[model samples]
Target: MRSVFLALLVAFFATGVAAHVARSNSLRDEKLTFNPTNVHVKRLAHTPRTLTNAQRLARGLNPARPQLRSSRRLAGRGGPSLTPTTTSTSTDTPTGTDTTTSTDTPTSTDTATSTDTPTTTSTDTTTSTDTATSTSPTPTPTCTAHTGVLELTGGSYNGYVSSETNSFGEYSVTTDASEALQVQYQECDGAVSYGPINFKTLNGLSTYPYLGGIVGFSSSSDNLASNSPNYVYLGGTQESAAGAPPQRGANSFSAASGTAKDYESAIWSVDPTTGAFTAHWVNTDGTSSAPTIMVVQDAIVLTDDTFRFIQTYGDAVIVSLTFAESSSAAVPPQATSSA
Candidate 1:
């Protein structure tokens, strides 16, 4: 009987060791390799696997069998809970498809950059264009052209053709016969009547500068002096031969001769021999007054065929006096040339 009891004890010990090993293997499977107490193993070994609790008690064993503790419980009591520390080597294929949806940030940036560049370029272009336009220049105007050229012969007188107050010597006009014509001013103390009026140029008269058109034997050459040919004063007094009273306030008349003399009267007439002529003037004065009349020393017979004289009064040259003639009018002086 004692041998029997020893054998039984040894078997029980063997069963406990087996159970402990089994539990250890199970724990290992669960990744919970925590060691448990012998008492825990004994309890697992005595746990009935096939029979009910009543049957086991009738079999003369403890009414309640020892229960095997779960590996999770054992781990909780002995050490850190070994849940499948399954580092689920989820092949950390970090499926983090680093889907870095890098939105087209550079595209927007490039568009803005391009826009800014064009603005700068446009500004520079506009500035350059404006500079060019501002630096340009304007044009100037020219003078008008002339009508005709003329020559002086015998008889014909010359008329005034400028608004400027020009006179003999400084600027002068003569008859066709080279006789110096004068715009005479007579200080008359009597009532005098004038002769019939005459129109010289095809276009009658000019109202400005002088109210009446010039009355004399004027050559067509003098009419081309300026645009409006009307301002002239024939410095000579009325004579009896011109159907005018020779002297209204004086008894006799003396014509002007010496230097700086003012001829008082003159007469203009058409002769059968001479086309237009100026009769000799009479009654002269040499005094210079506040508003002095034009005085003459001598007449200027043009020597050059083409003569150009600039008539000026105050500021600007009013008329361009140009004289051109035919060769027939330029007769050379002979030994018997008339004076």
Candidate 2:
């Protein structure tokens, strides 16, 4: 038994030596394993007097809440309810083949997203703070095929072409002699008086941030069905109302049907040249106190995608606005040159 014990000890030491040799040889090829991040506690900033530590702690959770990722763009709609404003659109082709809708969602490929919500979460032992910040996103690169690059010589405005039946993923750029031509990489479903609207590809759009359809219903005030492409300002009062004077280039006839309670002043306006809505306005049932909600939609850049411009104005406000492009008539593509 003693001799057997000595032999076992020798075998164990010999095995350990072999294992050491193997480990030394594997040192160069061995992979490093990183452990999970350790729990970290942090101080949350506030107005100092606003939310006390007790209040913050009251909202605290012992174990972190299970996070359900945010809803994706192509997520299916839930059971139907009284959501009259709910619009659904399908994932469109890159060639702009599908007729877009208010409900249709542009695939994530058309729009890249980043989280910007500011939040502070606390637990029994730890606290965390998150903030939302504005940032310009990187521009999407376009295939350098010279399909619809159009340009003109001496014009103050830009232009648009409406012939392409399959323009979903396709983007085009056009310009007058002056400005760099703007391009539309993708089209989502929204009734737009699209006049060379700017889709700033670089730094995500921050300054001139708000983009809208040239002629679509307001997100909130839709029961009134305030459609665009009308003289958004010329309503509730006569062309020669008490406070309202005659507007220039205003529609010659009323757009509404039946015994007109009021002249059908255009609910929206478009650029005649490029045919896009430059401004969005609301008629206040003839109440003459407020001037108008002259929302500046976009500016007139040579690089813009202008189809037509609508001329609209009112007595109190001149409404010197920019325009988008629209064209029901046959439009020929313009010539564009790359630098």
Pick the TM-score winner. 1
Give the runs in model 1 whose Cα sits over 4 Å from its true position.
1-262, 272-274, 282-339
Q: Which stretches of candidate 2 lie over 4 Å from their true place?
A: 1-178, 186-211, 214-339
Q: How does residue 107 of candidate 1 score in lDDT?
A: 22
Candidate 2, residue 319: how far the Cα is off, in Å:
19
How large an RMSD does model 1 have? 75.0
Error of 1 at 256 (Å): 17
Q: What would the TM-score be for candidate 2 when compared with the true structure?
A: 0.16
Cα-based lDDT for every prediction: 0.24, 0.26
Model 2 alpha-carbon miss at residue 245, Å: 33
Model 1 per-residue lDDT tens digits across residues 22-89: 99877644442111122111100111234455533322223466688765644435676555322111
* lDDT string, candidate 2, 286-310, tens digits: 3321122222222211101111112
